[model samples]
Target: MTEALLNVVGVSRSFSAGEDELTVLKEINLQINRGEMVAIIGASGSGKSTLMNILGCLDKPNKGHYFINGQDTSAMDENELAALRREYFGFIFQRYHLLGDLTALGNVEVPALYANEGPHERQKKATQLLTRLGLSDRLEHKPNQLSGGQQQRVSVARALINGGDVILADEPTGALDSTSGEEMMKLLRELHRDGHTIILVTHDPHIAEFADRVIEIKDGEIKDGEIIGDTRNDNVNAYQSSDRAATELVDNPPQTHPQTAKQQTTKYRINWSRYLEALKMALIGMSNNRLRTFLTMLGIIIGIASVVSVVALGAGSQQSIMANIASMGTNTIEIKPGTGRGDRRSGRIRTLMAADADALKTLSFVDSVTPTVRANVAIRYASETVTGSVQGVGTDYFRVRGYSLAQGQFFAEGNALGSVIFLGHLPVRVIGVTEPIESVSSNSDELNVWLPYTTVSGRIFRQNYVSDITVRVDENVESEVAEQGIISLLTMRHGTVDFFTINTDTIRKSIEKTSATMTMLISAIAFISLLVGGIGVMNIMLVSVTERTREIGIRIAVGARQTDIMRQFLIEAVLVCFCGGALGIGLAYFVGVIFSYSGSDFQMVYSGTSIIAAFACSTLIGVLFGYLPARNAARLNPIDALSRD
Candidate 1:
């Protein structure tokens, strides 16, 4: 009278070949309650396997309603069905489905991953399960290293992890020798006695005798299904193979859409339980080419460091430059002439004149415009001729050119022209002036200088035109708007976009933006390296899968579900990328420091964002690129996999 753990009513599944429709299952009905074991017995072509597939929810019947724990399976989507399977069913098969990369304990811990238990709890549970399954000694051993019985035991332990009520076993004893097969049957009997609802599919009549019920499937339908013996609906304690504690081996199956399972994979093993395995694998991988790994990591380090350092140092340099410019005066706009020495009005005209500079002062937004004359003349102090460049400017030039006189005051307006000039440090030092040019000390020939424009207005240095017209706009106006206005005015005045251009505050921002763009480009390049690293991870994992094929086949054969295989490989890949990312982050910071110290204006910058970004990016690359190899490992046929060697 107890509620059936599983109920299949009028279920049918079929396939079409050319014009013929072949029914795999036809109008079948089956019901099983708690604490009972049953077998569907038939020959290879008799559709028992097809029925088993439908029973396991690995495949859907063409027509039928399969209810598990009273939930209508037909009403559920693939995702819901997968979730239900994970939560409510376990599986065992003829070939043990033990994961190759994972030790016995790790294999046992696979199903619990979907439950999201912490690593500590998962490991504890896995350990207990392996011990109860008599795999305690094989806990650290890979499936390849274990005997057939041992591998099956690990699969059994994995299946039992979630304590799922039903065990759907397909050919539970098909791949084993008689002794191993008998042992497996004994284990199944023990599980049945422990209150598990098991549906076993087999062809051997002797195997069917162990079940409380037997369904003889022929063609594509259940020809006869009858309860062969008294079925226990209460606790079947005697059937529980382990006694150390029920926690020894729990039961749970995979949760994944079969179709999507063929496409995307999102599976991972318990990290804490398999941390050592991952670490060991990492060590082995690293040892395989310590120098290559180190060098590859070094490239990432340098790349990250170069990028970070450049950002930091560039930011600092820009900050300093902006400060200097601001200090020089924000209202100022540069009007320096170009290198082309063409006539002021000729084709591709570049040579500027004082007249053009004077005309700019008349603009409505303009406040002050100073015509500036410049020449690298070797002026004599007294037998000492210094070839440093001399700047002959109007009174307003000091405010526009960011000239902070190192010492004495600058030139005055309308003052009488004398042999006076404000020199920069280079000019001051060049003249070998021991003291200030006037009342102040200039220890070296400081070159910074200032002079009235009229002084050089007709001299050999300049006659009519000045090289530049530094414009100081109204302080109240937003400098950017003023600069743009000035650019528009000048571009119109010049009548040619190529005849020198304006690069004011508006354009200055574009430079910083361009720097950011360059950073992105560099980042893209670095990501390529990470991808190469990901490929390394994938390649390594694929190799591992090949080496462990037999082990995988064993787990799948016994009871290790598809998801278990996927988790183990993905975890391995993620581990590799994470380790690489951590190292890369550290390297980037150091490179940033180096860039900061370099003399170049550009410096590297590091951010917590970048560090996390690097890690996340690597993880994504691992999953995106790693999943293919991982899935290939997971999807390998158990029959073909174990038969490899």
Candidate 2:
């Protein structure tokens, strides 16, 4: 007895129809032997197509069992069913069902792609199949570019790509003209002659005549309720009676055995080839919808740019501020009369004096010291009288303040007491002008006059005590340690703490802390935009999945695994975000260039770490937002997806 290649025993399929169950097929029993060309004829809505789908593993029956070559299909999982579809069966749809974006050869190679065939091998086989089907000149033509007959030929070629042990064709000639339909039937007969079990589903009686045995189905049940064919019969006589020319054309048809094709389904630990193919598909999808892809990336671009630019701006501003602070002299301390600035009696507590400066200079930790006395005065220089601040200081004041001379020299040790500018009523000679200091407290427009404390205290204010003292600490000592020493020495000398000291180092630390806090707060706010962008990606990808439902169906029908479908969409999403990240990084650098040209005191300083982090963040957003859409696409029912308009 001949073994049945495909067997269906007591199978029933039902669908939900608005609270009522609609049974499409009931108690269906059939058995198809190898190398037999059988035609299943039925009218529209007769469930013949559903039966074909079930037989091809595209749909499962709600009840009973289906077996393929003694292996029960009811026991197979989705992947296993997919493997069966890929290795054992090939479908030729009534509508041709070719992917519009792919060429004739490309469409033919899809099944082999899922079968884990190498690109070179699949392409060669696809080319050979198409050429043998009389489409040698149309290998690169897309489906839309071909005639009905040419497309059907390409569909036939695709069906044979993976050995196609059992060919389940659903109204394969329904869409073609009489001449094309005849050609397609003739081609099917040729395939049937080459040891293939061909199951043809059609409504036309004339088409049924081409099959060796005709099985008529009506209202989801076999006519007369029998299996309809003999247990075993030789199909050689049937092939010999076919048209001689068509059989001669496929005399040496590609010999791909079902068992050999089945062995190819044993996959590797990581199918890098499938991933690479998915990546290629992702690029093609992105290229085909350039505008939509870019629009989807817009939010990510703006978010990444904002985050990187804001961080760079914060870093740059902080650097500029620190530089200005450094101009005021590093590790410097100021001593002023009174306990603090808010003290009401600070002006009257004039215990801080020149002696304190001299005493601080004597300490090992003190690098230099200057006693300062200030008086606002009017000075006449060449008949131009300007009100200015006159500061009295020791000769080392300019050096301790980190001031460099612009044009004039500072006071000599001997001339400190002799040369001075004559203020409103005091007699003083103009000696020298120091360079402009770039400290935070120094204003470029403010006129400053410096003189010896001996001259200012004796000739002008006539006060024995200095207004304040400035001490530059040695580089070897920490500022806080030097501050403690100065406080203790001053307390002992004065018998009490009558003055307050301001450490520049402490001010630097506080300013740095504040700048960092503000940066983090702003960066966090910018990060919100990234989250919004990720949501946008998810929304767009969901819409894309809906739009490409038919495409997904086609891939699944052509033996694609759920993982394969998910991987392609996921890769596309990730590519969009990654490209957006690259563009965003470029935009940030461009913004930096624009900022530099604006003549600002500071330049934007980009960090390598921040740029890398931004790139990683964009990629993460892609994966996080893309998974939902990919999963939804992967989980779509193939039959429903194909039925969707």
Candidate 3:
């Protein structure tokens, strides 16, 4: 009936002056109808580009109430404006605005790539458009390989790939020769003929003539504006039809305009097809700069690898230490007798004696008490004597340690002085065994002799049996409490805080502390790699901004919001690093395999949480380091960008 496509009333724009605000545009009014072409023409500094930017949704006016196809423009923020632009506008720029590294089809595919379209959709659309532009042969040819006219065609094709509602062309041929310029202008006319609504901004009067309507601005004011060749003789008839249809459409609406708040609004929804295209574009970009991408990713990869490797190593070391300590015995308490060195109240005083060991055995919680008298001793087995440390103890040593007899049976009580001795499997392997050794060396070749500790022909091996007492507490008693009770009992003999003591729980705590410190140290070293990678991403993204200056300008001119540009660069950076992180994860897995082969008793658990954390960190680095470069691109003046060589 009387549906409005775009409405702008009394819009004004200005900038700062020394002390007074300088007016750029004053009281500008304009409207654009669906399926129509309008050109805005003016000299430089006449605010024509500024007005075009507002109309293309690139910016908001300093003072204006504007509506586009019935949607209010005043209420949108930068991101919302970007979504609106992506949903509705396609931009073609002067200077061909083609990315130097991309082929013709790639140039056409950039926008859809930003939209993240699928590869199939991007390829089909890009190929179809390039073919239509007579660039089927040049699809694989890069921008430098094509003529200026052909490059502009690629740009035009890019604008058309997304099914956007409007095309915004800013001086579309300003950088082309006359013939090539004419060719590009003809392409625009062709696009218009194909039913696309276009708003071409140009200073050339001939270029403005290509549009169906032209608005001329001078000194920031519209000097002339009008539409031609659409005049109908019967205004009364047209107005009468509009008047009647307005009431009918408004009253008996098929759908309520102001439906309940819960209803879904009618904003255009961008298909997910473009996002896939963006991913493909990113892949191509990385391929074009393979070295840069690899270098960038190397930081993250090395960091993750170092983290995993160091953690594995540290974890293994901790386990080994704990196992060795626990292997000695579980819930075993150590009691050391000290010679009198200082204060008698101190445990260093010689208060513990063999009598103390006898007294400890009487305690209710004590399972078994083994008094160890260790020294290097020689074994005489028919002149093949081997020397090793001796552990002199009663039969109770076997009960507390539960050591397996790989060779011979443990010594029995009555076997004392019967030439009986138990050799550890390690020592047994060192010495050769000739006899069956049914008494001692049944498993190993070691030559050991065990004799009674009570009396061996009246010869004394040990004087005081309390050098160290290994107290095996009952498992029925909790280790910590039992240890405390043992400490209290021994403290009287070896006074308070006199002797160094440890238990199963104490060793376990030490192991945990060691593991924690190791994990943190490894992580710190790994983070250095990530930081280096972040610097790489930042550097590359900055380069990209500089390289794609004109492209960024074109996107902004076409209604791409600031955040859109930010997202493009940030995602590109992140994609590169994240890809590297993924590869690193694979590499770490291989390293884990290698570690397993090396006989390291550690489980290299590269859990999903770790992978996701690495990936997320990579992405975060991209956003953090790529932000400034992206912002630099976004803050660029669209006119200056279009004018860039």
Candidate 4:
């Protein structure tokens, strides 16, 4: 005779119950032939369903050998068993086992997708199956939207999608009414007549009578096995004569030829269609729970915003400071008396003089030169009496200091001050009022006055020596080189190194270094916040896995591989963080806009590199933090997952 399509020899199954092993099936011997309609009937808890699970390769037997078409399945791995289920066996459950998130058409196409079918092919096949199953109008309806009978019909269509060579129905009609039950049994009979091997597990005698052979199972043992019914021939004649609609329902035969084991084991190539389906499912999951998704993304949003904003704020502050420095004179040098600052007895030296300024002005590298002498004096102007510094300066002092006048012009060589101001009981005219210089002093209330050096030395203090000289270096000359030239000339004239020069360029370098350090420090703190956001993503993903346990089981039942399940959850997590990153960038820009409008002295300067880095960081967090949850989902036992609420 033909080799048995399914052969079970001495198969004994057991489950752990507390401290002891509870045996479910004992020495179960069964044989099922291709193209034969058989029923394994028993009462509840009789292990009939367990036997059917073994036959369908959904569960393994503790002891014995189960074979499919003369090939032993004892050495097959989890993935190999999944391939068997995908290519050969199809399951119909009492609860209908339809994915809640998928439409009827989508649910029917699931198995075909896992079988590596293309989108257009699977969609066309799914549409035809649903249309023939009387669900053409309900193709887009979700499981919750369909009635009990309609859902079971969709489940039947799903089972037949990937060539159901052997169909296992575990109480398929238990949840349906009498009329719907009769209709379902009729559909099964039609499939059986179309050369599909039908294995029905039920306690209802009426349902058992529809099959050609009935095996009575009791207490995990086959009690009576015989060909009790001659219903095949009679049903064939009756169906042909009376059930014209049922004949039209299953007019086209299912695809019975499946890929060989070698073909199934071929190295898996990247399937873009499968990945796209996973992406679509991920989007649907996120859309269904908008609040949870947004909350999960909030941490990433805050972290990315902090990092980008801090970088921008640092850059803006640095630019503002550098601009102020530039206004003080690009290449200016200051000459002070004595060896250096805070020197003792420098006032008694009296070596610096106006002749030095006149000599420096003759050099080609010196743009302008000014000699300065200062003394604290009491000044009276309009009813305000204040102590201020009265400075003796050359005609080019304003040009050397890069000062712009707010009102009135600088005094000429012999011109007197325009307005009289008292200096130590001597009255002197004011030449001009300089614009407010931020670099000069922090206190805006400080007072200053300027006069010609000759007037201060001869008329006011009656001293001939000058305190110091200020030099504006030519644009083509380096400040350091010019400083060296002046030191050489002055030390030769004085016969010793009695003065020191301060290069404004050196101060600019120091300030820039300090600003950069501050930016790096703040950015490091922001990176810590990003790390915390990654941890938050991991926690929420763990919760998601627990909530969708049943959904995971459904995919497994439809032949989804471990990697397929993992890809779904991982992609969902990445999408969450990616969207969060985009929102965070937007938030950072919004902060910049508000800061600019607040009338602050400096504006935020956002960097393109920082924004791109933030996006990469968020995507990496999604993968790093999302792995454990995805692995937990993929590693779940199919039976345990299905049984969970």
Candidate 5:
């Protein structure tokens, strides 16, 4: 004899309620034949729904063995049971537990996706099924947009998408009007005629009259394990009369053949099609709630923009400071009379003199030495009188200080003792005379006047002392070693080390280091904002998981593994963060450009590495913060999730 399609032996199920065990089903022994329409009927609070759930592999039986085609279901794991539901059983929920995020056509393709069906095949099959159910015009409508009867039809189409032989519907028409209910019953009858086994649970006795067999269940026990009420003798006769056709239909189900069957045998372990479908759904969900999505992304955008801009500004500041230092020559040292200390007595030193400058120039690595004498003198240029510094220097001042002559020439060697002087810190025409060095600054520009050392000591200051001296060392020599030599020489010449001070490349490096540290501090503060943004993302994702509990349940019902649901939410979060990060990068550059053009001293340098790092970090933040919410969603109990409002 052929084995029964579904067999239940002494099945019982219970729940713990207030320290008392309430049994829902007890010793339910039943057998459903292939291609038979069996209805399990009972009043309110009866165990008919529980029996249907167990039959559908949606819930486990506590004390029984359920066999599907002689294979015991009790030994199967959750994944295997999900496969059985995906490949062999189709459920039609009473409330039409459709995914609100998916349209009718997408909903119908769900089971096929889990079965690893190709997109074209699933689409074609879903289209045909939806059209056959008279929902072709409503294929793109979401659940909330559809009427009760239309939704019921969509659910029916979903149940048949995987070519399942067993249709376990729990109160399929319980929520519909009479006319819609009658239409639903007729569709089930047609499916039964087409060689599908229909196990329906209902409370309506009239509805049970149409089935080939009705098993009445009260409380947790079956009243009679046989056909009752309306016998449907004519329907039984028709089934018997068409037994040969039914057998043929069962052997070769609709829209399937030898090649398709052979292809089905090679089940794909990883269903990328489901992932693609999930991504599409996630995008749709985000788009539908545009305001919330944007609000959620705002934190990341601001944080990344702040960080990128700070880093860019810091880089620009370092470059600018180094450039300013390079203008004075990296191998140059400045020797001022005072020690670099915050004391007035230490600054009043007249130890550095013209002889010291000549002595320094005689060193092996020293290229040039220019002793400076500063006088606050007033110059009159064509009715303009300005008071500024008139500097006395040697002829090699330009080469030593990295300054350039935009127009006029420097003083000749013969003019060293001559009265001829190159004027700076004054207007181009002084007393109807044109002077050089007017292009570099808007205020008092320094004028270079070359004079013999003896002439400057006697003529300008009437003293033999110089305020400061600059030494240009050869590029091949170490400036630090030269600095030590200059200090030792000055100490010996002055007879006291506290009387003079010298610096070589140390001031520029100190400035660069200080600027860098400031920049890092700013960047660190920006990262704190990024951390705040990550926390915001976590909160928003948790709220999203809570809001979509029902939708999560529907996906699980359609054969979505926990990982699938987890991945879907994770993708949504990452997509939001990536988009925000991209926008932040754009904003950073835009603001940088504005600041650069706005004549601010703070310039921004956009680095390729910084942009890439910012975006990568933002994506990582999404993943790190989104995991908890995704895990919460994945670990949800499908039964409880479905019941959530």
Candidate 6:
């Protein structure tokens, strides 16, 4: 008189085996009314599991239609199928299908987690259900710590968590011992009497007799379909074994609001509580295998540390170079002559003259111009005969080159141009030292001998050619404008621009550019290591997915969408990498401090951008590489994963 809760018509299923097709279920039809206890009995490979898969909507029938609660399921999408499972069906596997990482209470709360229940409500319901199942004292025990009978009881409580009315049991008592199996059958019968529709698959006729109806399948076809009367003559009795517990469970019954609870859960969206719970479960999963988790994260840590350290060192080198350049003065420029254009044999340009120097001084932004002529000569200062290069320059050379005198006054201009050649090759004499010079070979001014331009040109070398010119630019004038003026005047005087080179704004910029380029190059090289780290992450995550196939299946059967599975795994990967990045930054900082305090010339520089970039890249690496494994996990067939050993 009432509509059947589930209906199947002309349903069939098949699989491809290399070159041939294998049909698992052929021309099968069945119907299950509400509150009816039905048994599907068959031998192995009889297509009973396939039919059950179709009935539970975990798989689709190839050539027929199936309807649940009067709605055809053949045309439904994945989201709708997931919703259907959550709203209507509950599953209990023979192996219990409990997540090993979660506690007994946590396992019972899983379906409710997907239901978007509040934490308090979910935990309360889980506690109540466990207490009813006689697992109150063992609520915190993990699956591996529980006995076979206790695990099955936990699965029963999980099935009923979302207020699902139909229970699909596939060989629920197959793995248990005689006593445990008997107790499980008694629990199923009690559930059936309490207005729950039960469909069980088993090969034992004794198990089938406990149901109100039995359908026997053989060779992918139904061979016998019979309705059995309840004789109530079985020795298995749940009431006798645990009468007090059964009475309490019946009275409380896990509080179902009937249509309203299912409706609310169906319309539910995931919130922070569910995400936090997933994270908590993932952490627990990782913590159980601590060594493996650390091994998986090691690659990421090394990669991040390498990147940060290299960049910091580069930044420090750049800073040191810039500081040295600043000490040489930013507003100074040096000019030199290029070699003869077509003839490389003439390396010196002898055309520079004093008249050209006078022309450069007339430029608007030119502060001072000094013509230089260098010649190595031996100076006999008492007993110390120091061989050094003498620079022929003017009084403005001291101001233009940022040189300060440590002792003795500079020679006046009157004696500078006097053509008095002192015998014994006294070309020029060292008048002062700029800073405390260490030795003649050190980079200092101790060996430098300065003399006036006119004296060296007319008296010492006996020639009028100048070697090079130095120009000091005004603070207000741009270097480009001043350089162009100098180049134009010198080219006009010489009638050729190729004979000379003009430099302005010192060598600081070139050296800075070189340091920056080197930093980028090292960082790029380090990035390769990061990419390798990413590959390592993907490899380990793939292995993890394979190792936890059964757990993934358990989540799917309880109404987790593909997105839910993807989100969980993605979060796990990001958490690992982000944490690794933080640790790497800390390591680098520690290394930097040690280097700075060791009294060495090497300095480690810390850049906020470098650390931030490393952090962001770590998270990005997780997303990029974690995708393949998460996708593989999400796309797995629920039935295949559930059946995985």
Best by lDDT: 2
Q: Candidate 1: lDDT of 337? A: 57
Per-model TM-score on C-alpha atoms: 0.54, 0.82, 0.64, 0.79, 0.77, 0.75
Per-residue lDDT of model 5, residues 204-311, tens digit only: 878886788878776534442222333333445334224554344334433424656546555333455566866787799899889989988888999999999999
Q: Rate the local accuracy (lDDT) of all candidates.
A: 0.63, 0.84, 0.66, 0.83, 0.77, 0.77
| Tens-digit lDDT string for candidate 3 (511-544) | 6697888788778878887788688778877877
lDDT tens digits, residue span 1-645, model 1:
555667889888778878998766677878866666777877777777777766666667788799876777888764565555565667676666655556787777766755555667878998998888777777889878998878777777777787746787878778788998899888888777676777888989888777877777665233432222234333323243333243222232233456456243333334453454435544554555566555434534444444444445555555665554444444467665553335465333445666666777777777777876676666656445556656668766655544454434556423333343323222232211212231111223566444567766555443666667678777567777877776677667666543343335544355557756775776566656555666666666677678778766654443445665676667656665666667766666666666567766655434566666667876676677569877997788654676676
> What is the RMSD of candidate 5?
7.1
How many Å off is the CA of 256 in candidate 1? 22
RMSD of each: 11.0, 6.1, 8.7, 6.4, 7.1, 7.6
Give the residue spans of candidate 6 off by over 4 A. Answer: 220-275, 328-331, 334-433, 436-446, 449-506, 597-599
Off by over 4 Å in 1: 1-5, 16-20, 68-71, 112-129, 220-602, 605-645
Q: What is the lDDT of candidate 2?
A: 0.84
Residue 539 of model 5: what lDDT? 97
Best by TM-score: 2
- List, residue by residue over 94-136, the lDDT tens digit for candidate 2: 9888988889999999999998888999999999999999899
**Per-residue error at 290 for model 2, in Å?**
0.9
lDDT of 5 at 235: 49
- Give per-residue lDDT, candidate 2, residue 225: 26
**Collision pairs in model 6:** none
